[model samples]
Target: MRILLVEDNTALADGLSALLRGSGYAVDVVCDGVSAEAVTATENFDLVILDLNLPDMGGLDVLKGMRARQSKAAVLILTARGATEDRVRGLDLGADDYMSKPFDVSELEARVRVLLRRQAGLRSSAVHYGKVSLDLNSRSFSADGTPIDLPARELGLLELLFLRAGKVVSKEAIMQSLAAFDDDLSANAIEQYVSRLRRRLAPYGLTVKTARGIGYYLDRPTEPA
Candidate 1:
């Protein structure tokens, strides 16, 4: 999934960006609130990590802009202000969760997983497709209860396809979900990833089906007649 991280602290932003990317998310960082508002308006993100102390504008106003623009991405507010009113106001303004400064990175990561899963209408951390299962917390895949190792990009592709299992996910949609702001991910690259995943999962009776001029979907192997 993709995340938009808005913070003015360069060091903190760098650390969080590295952490999220390493955990299989495409992250884009912007240092101020105006940029945050503009990017959230234009791009699609699964989650937004907003710092309320932005230099250009207040982070709450940024959240307002996002909601006004009808962006449905889950918002997690991060601020040093731990007052009850601040947390209540942010929650009232559509923030999904709030985290205070000096928080644990591990907890932040866990909350991120929960918010993303909630956004996807998923009730559990692990989702299954036929004989395959994906563990969102561990970022691991399994086939028939056995672990399967996959590169990060392929794993991301599989997650996207598996989450939207029956739907035809367009190349454009996949690119948006998998690529960072600066990354130039082409349709050809998506095709290659899909091909590799197909080969890797074929033995397990899982297939990714192409919709010809449209997109792709994950398909279960046909049953015997």
Candidate 2:
């Protein structure tokens, strides 16, 4: 999943970025609200972690801007403002969830999972495609009831493909979903990941099909006519 984290504290942002990236999410960090607004306007994100105390603008105003732009990304308010009134205002302004400072890392991670899953309209912690199964909670993969280990990037690619199985996903969309703003990921790199994943999944009757000049899609093996 792709996430935009807006926070002014460098240390906190770095820590959270590492944590989320370790969890297989593509995270972009911005310290000010204006940058947040600009990024949201241009790029797509699955989630936004906004802090109310931005330098250029209040996080609430940023939230308003996001809604004004008709952004469908789920917003999670993570701020030092613990006032009930602030929370009410944020929710009334369309924040999906709110978390105060001094929060537990585990709880924050759990909330992130919940918000992302909710945004995707997924109810279960696991998703299945034919013989391939993905455990959302653990980020593990299994084929035909046997476990398989994959690199983090490959796993992220698989998740994106599985979520939109049967639909043609463009390379640009995959790059946006799998890479952060600062990530030096290129189209060639994406092709490499796809190739590796294709090889890994082919043994289990799964296929990652290419659309020639377009992108790729995930599917089961074709049946004989």
Q: List the residue pairs that clash in candidate 2.
A: none
Candidate 1 displacement at residue 150 in angstroms: 0.9
- For all predictions, the C-alpha RMSD in Å is 1.5, 1.9
lDDT tens digits by residue: candidate 2, 19-43: 9999989999999998998899999
Per-model TM-score versus the true fold: 0.97, 0.95
Consecutive 10-residue window with the lowest summed lDDT within model 2: 216-225
TM-score for candidate 1, please give it.
Answer: 0.97
Model 2 regions more than 4 Å off: 221-225
Choose the strongest candidate by TM-score.
1
lDDT of 1: 0.92
Model 1 clash pairs are: none
In candidate 1, residue 104 scores what lDDT? 96
